[model samples]
Target: MPSPLRLHPDRLLPAEPGLRAIARELYAAVRELPILSPHGHVPAQLLVDDEPFRDPAALFVTPDHYVTRLLHADGVSLADLGVGRGPLTEPAARAVWRVLCERWPLFRGTPVRFWLDTELADIFGVTERPSAQNADALYDRVAERLAGADYRPRALFERFGIAFLATTDDPADDLAAHAALASDPTWTARVAPTFRPDRYLEPDRADWCKAVDHLGEVAGIETGDYAGYIAALEARRRYFVEHGAVSADHGHDDAVAEPLDARDAERIYRSAYAGQVTAAEALAFRRHMVVEMARMSCDDGLVMTLHPGSSRNHHAPSFHAYGPDTGSDIPRRTEYTTALRPLLERYGTHPGLHLVLFTLDETVWSRELAPLAGFYPSVYVGAPWWFLDAPDAITRFREAVTETAGFSRTSGFVDDTRAFCSIPARHDMARRLDAAYLARLVGEHRLDLDEALETAVDLVDGQPRRVFRL
Candidate 1:
């Protein structure tokens, strides 16, 4: 017989009896609160269409880079896992499932294991631990569940208790699906698009000119000149706001946002448009656009979120084969203090601007990020993001930022997932971890039990809504 699989009721709780009890109490109070995912890669079309998901591998093993990256590291081929392939047949997909099950031991204590185990047991009702022996059976069971009405994407969205969902979208996107969902009387859930302008900022890229031309066509502003380009971006921001978006997201190479002189900016824009820009000129132009984005936020009331310091596509071969977000991206050391001074000096205190800064670099959390959030009314520290969204890192984030910025000044936990089913699992883990952290505070007498409980609830419900302006 297969070993029975079950999730511990207090899996992430503190070990001490007193602290465990307090954590359990705190968790119970906010365990079922609605999830507010303010920044994520989940496509708006998925929820809008309400289509049944494809297969087990397509749904779970393939789309999630978190799972694929690790498995690839263990000598699994990306093509075998359906990474770059169009779609996997049921048999082909089951082969991938077998790989995951056979190597279950490899994921012994990883967060991916935690999430998959939770999803299998809680969502799909898998009663046995997956192994090479039971991989086919587990795959069949999950496939059956997915074909059911309750397991459909919209049903799962509702079942997951998502109060507000934000999807990252290019500035040129029309948000047709978002509009469709908003007008559908049957769909009452709030789904909003977040304006993402990373492509427009990188003039050194091969497709930069084409993207600029596309933006001009969509926004009805000429891109041949710097003034018209700025107008086009501003127009898109307003369009997003009209469609219920409340935030603009930026993922740049760094956090620098210094402004260039108008003459220099115009010269560079003309050169970049002509496809003759140098690497240094491209970096300077991108940095300058960051400040311009801040200015746009101040004018339009859209929250500005900065995700910086990801060295994307570290492995050239894999990136070439699988394309970006195939999990080859790596993080490098990043300094925020000197890099953000230009932007901060200009709009750091602007009453209308809300700048939430995120980093893969944890070194700056206490030293730079916290202090910046504490000082500026507009600056808020983004939650532990990308590689730092694990249990230990989440705890460290709280410890690092709380003393300087406090709870209110920090953006709450965002799931930032593309796996539709993992939404609840991710949010639940965060809630449990937050409860445990608060329980420790209460136990230490640093915070009262009642206050800790209240704060725990706020972190789940109030914080995201307030921080993202939902």
Candidate 2:
């Protein structure tokens, strides 16, 4: 028989009895707070359509790069996991589940294991730890539950206690699903779109010209020149705002946002338009556009979220076969101080602008990001993101940034996930860790218990609504 699974009540609390008690009190006070997912990758159509999940593997394994990448590390083929491909047959899906269950031991001590354990036990009544012996049975059990209304996407959204969910979308996207959701009187959940303009900013990509032209067509602007392209983007930002978008999201190679002279920018744009741009010119144009985007945010009132330093599609083979976000995007050492000086100097203190900075590079938490956010009224430090969203890293983030920027200047915890079910688990982890951190402060007399409780609540309820302007 598989070992019985049970989540410990004090699993993430501090070990000291006094501190643990304080954490328990703080956690209890805010554990049930509604989730405000200000930034994530979950497609809005999933909730708009409100379909029952197809199967356990599809719901939990296939869409989650976190699971597939680790499984790929242990010699499982991405093909076998149904990645980069269409839906799998029932037997094929079960085979993927078998692989995950057989290799479950490999995930020991990782946050993946923690998230999976919490999801299976808490959400699905999965009481037995997964193993090859129980793989088929567990799959069948989840499949059965998924067929029920309780497990449907919209129902699960409500059950998850999500008060607000934000999905990242291209600026050119029509957001038909978001529009449908907004119009449906039956749907009460608040789902918003975030405008992501990275592809339109990159001139080196083969599809850059095509995407720019398409953006012009969608926004009803002429894109034969630089001014028209900028107009097209500005128009789309307004369209997204009309349909309930509050932020503009950028994921670039770095954080640099220096503006170029009008002549230089137009020259680079003309070269790019003619498909004759050099690599250096492409970077310059992209960097210049980032500055322009900040100016647009200052005018439009959309919060500017800068998530930089991801070396996306690091493995050519996987990228070619499966496309991006298949788990090969690796983080690199990033320096933000000098890179962001141009943009910060220009509009970092603008009253209308809210710049939320995210990084895969943890080294900048105290050295650069905290100091920048500490002084700038408009800048906010985003939560520990991507590889750093794990338990220890979350703790490190708090300890590193709190002294300089404090709680108010920090963006509340964002899940940044495509896996819908993992939303609550990720946020719960953050809340638990925050409670523990605050409990330590209260125990050490750095902060009183009442203040800790208030901080905990604000971290969950107030901070996200304030920073993201939800």
Candidate 3:
């Protein structure tokens, strides 16, 4: 017989008797708080379509790089898992599901394991551990549930108790789905778009000129000239705000935000647009745009979020085959205090600026990030992100930064995920870990019990609202 799958009542709490009791109480106080995912990747169209998920494999494996990347490391091919190959037939989907089920041990002790377990047992009502023998049965059960109305995207969004969820979207997106949901009488929750201009900011990209042209076309500005190009970007950001975007998200190779003087900037822009920009000019232009993005945020009131230091798409072959976000994104050593100095020097004390800084580099959290947030009114240290969002890394993040920046300077947990169904499970894990962290403080006599409970609630509900201006 297969072992029953179950979630522990005191999962992620401390093992010590006293701390465990305190953590249990703290978790309860904030456990049911509405999830505030102020930054994420779930497509708005998913909810607007309100369609049933195609199948269990598509739901759990194909779209989630976090799942597929690991399985690939365990010697499974991306093609076999239905990645970047359009849709999968039922038999093909089940084959992928069986692949995962047989390799269940690969996920052991991972946050992916915890999240998938929660999703399987709590959301899908799966009662047995997934194994080769049970793969078909489990897939059938989940597929059957997904075929029901209650398992559709919008219904699951409501069931997840999401108070506010934001999707990262390009400037070119019209956000018609956002408007559709906002006008619907039956839908009450807020699902806002985030202004993401990654392609627009980096002019060295092969498609930069075309992207620039599209920006001009959309904004009704001329982009053959440099001034018109800047205006086009500003216009798009305003359009995003009009469509309910609260933040502008920036992810670049680095956080360097220096700007060139007007004449030099115009010179570089002309070169870039004419496909004549040198490598150094391209680097300078990209860095310059970071400052421009910050200045626009100050004027437009979009909270500026900088996610720097990712070496995105590390495997060139995989990227060429499957496209980006295929989970080869890696972290490099990032120097924030200096890299961000130019932007901060301009707007660090500007009351209108809200800059949330995220890093893939863990080393900078204590030495650089905390100090930066501690000094700058605009800078809030973003939560442990991407690779560092797991349990141990999160705990390390708290200890590293809390001493200097304190709790208020930290941006509350942002479950930056593309996997929609894992939203609640991710939020739950953060809540539990936070409770455990706070419970340790209470046990150590550093915090009163009541105070710890209040902090727990604020971490869940208040921090994201305040940091992201939700």
Candidate 4:
């Protein structure tokens, strides 16, 4: 007989029964709340086209680097797993599933295991444990369901209880898709874009000059000089605002920011354009641009989000084959105190600006991020992100920062996912973990149960919406 399938009644609850009950109650209150996904990489066209998802692999596996990377690490080839290659035929899907199921033991204690199990059992109603023998059957069942109308992107978005979803877009992007979705009266989904300008600003990026030229074309401004480049960026910011973008996103290897005079900035820009800048020059230019971007945000009234410490595209071969965001990116240690001093010193007191910071470096939670956010009028701490987007990390973040920065200083949970179906699962995990933590606080008499319940609700839904201005 097949082994029985079961899910923990209090999956992330405390070990004790009474506290588990409290956590369960708190989770129940916020579990059904609408998700406010202010930062994510889901394609805007999915919401624009309002089309049905093709299949299970397309929906669950192909776009998720977390799933694919784990499978890759376990000796499964990306091609055989139907990643970075082509569509998986039914037989190929079964093979991939069989391999994954046999290696399910690899994910035994991982958060990915929780997410996959939740997606399998809750989303697809698959009661059987995934294993080599049952893998093909489960794949067939999920594929059948995915072909149905109920599994379409828009329907699933509604079913997932996502009230707001924001997709990242380059500043040079025309955002015509966003415009199309906005004009469609039947589309009730509140989909918007976030401004991301890394390619145009970073001098070391391949085709930096080409990206700047594209920016000029989109913004209808000349890109012959530093002043014109700034003008082009400003124009794009205005266009992004018109198209319902409330936030601008920055992804950097470091949190470094610099203050430079016009002469020095212009000279650096010239070198950047000619591809003659040294590594130090490139970093300084990028740092100065952060300050420039912040000053622009103050005028444009767009929230600024900085995600630092990612050494993006760590694997050159995989990147060349599959392109960016294929799960090869790695995180490095980051410093915010000194790195962000120049930018903060200039705009730290700007009440009109909203600057949200995220780091993969957990070391900074108490030492740097919490203090900076606590002191700066414009600063707010982003959720525990990327490698740290797990239950333990979330709890640690609350514990580390709550005493100094407090709950209000941090932006509440944003799914920050490219996986659409995982949005609810991620949010559910966050809610359960947060509730469990708060229950512990109440148990210890550090916080009242009533206040904890209220705060739980705010953390789940209200805080993110308000912080990102959703």
The order by descending lDDT is: 2, 3, 1, 4
**After superposition, candidate 1 runs with Cα above 4 Å error:** none
lDDT of 2 by residue, 195-237 (tens): 9999999999999999999999999999999999999999999
* lDDT leader: 2
Give per-candidate clash totals: 0, 0, 0, 0
TM-score between model 1 and native = 0.99
Whole-model lDDT values for every prediction: 0.91, 0.94, 0.93, 0.86
> Model 4, which residues run further than 4 Å from truth?
none
| Candidate 2 structure, TM-score to reference | 0.99
Candidate 4, after superposition: displacement of residue 351 in Å?
A: 1.2
lDDT (Cα, tens digit) per residue for candidate 1, span 1-470: 88889899999899999999999999999998888999998998998777888888888889999999889999999998999898778789999989888888887777778888899899999989999999999999999999999998999888889989999999999999999999999998999999999999999999999999999999999988999999999999999999999999999888888899999999999999998999999999999999999999999999999999999999999999999999999998788889989898999899889999999999999999999999988899998887998889999999999988889998998888898888888888899999999999999999999999899999988888888888
| Model 1 lDDT-worst window of ten | 105-114
RMSD each, Å: 0.8, 0.7, 0.8, 1.5
Tens digits of per-residue lDDT for model 3, 228-325: 99999999999999989999999988889898999999999999999999999999988999999989999999999999888889999999999888
Better of 2 and 3 by lDDT: 2
Give TM per candidate. Answer: 0.99, 0.99, 0.99, 0.97
